[model samples]
Target: MIEKRAAQRHRVFKGGTITFENGGIACIVRNVSEGGAAIDLDAPVTLPQSFTLAIARDNLVRNCRPVWRSDRRVGLAFVQ
Candidate 1:
């Protein structure tokens, strides 16, 4: 297998949420790095181009964009 990630990700199992102006959805942080993260949603849901990912315990609120997605998981890139 080829490693294509720009940065190494750390495994995590923290609960989080994706928030938009309209609403939010529950998700789990599967892995994370400085550049991006992999999240698993409770169910398949359409996400906007940009949104905020909040992990309360970690005190993290990052602006992010979806880079890739499958059934119930999404890969996100941190955006300014």
Candidate 2:
């Protein structure tokens, strides 16, 4: 199979926050790459098309847009 991702993702286990207007949720970052990251949510919940993802331990924050989702996992594409 062909890999369509722009960058290779590395496995990760880090805490992250999915933040948007007056709201936020705790998430576990499962994988990361230059292009984007995959996060594990506590449960399935609606999220805005665009939001901020903060990884406190790394002191990194970036805007993200959802690319795909599962019951508890969300794939995000970093936006400039």
Best by TM-score: 1
Tens-digit per-residue lDDT, 8-63, candidate 2: 99999999998999899999999999989999999999999999999999999999
Q: List candidate 1 stretches off by more than 4 Å.
A: none
lDDT of 1 by residue, 1-80 (tens): 99889899999999999999899998999999999999999888989999999999899999999999989999999998
Q: Count clashing residue pairs per candidate.
A: 0, 0
After superposition, candidate 2 runs with Cα above 4 Å error:
none
* RMSD values, in order shown: 0.7, 0.8
Per-model lDDT = 0.95, 0.96
Candidate 1 has its poorest 10 consecutive residues by lDDT at 41-50
Candidate 1 TM-score to native: 0.95
Clashing pairs in 2: none
- TM-scores for all candidates? 0.95, 0.95
Residue 48 in model 2: shift from native, Å? 0.5
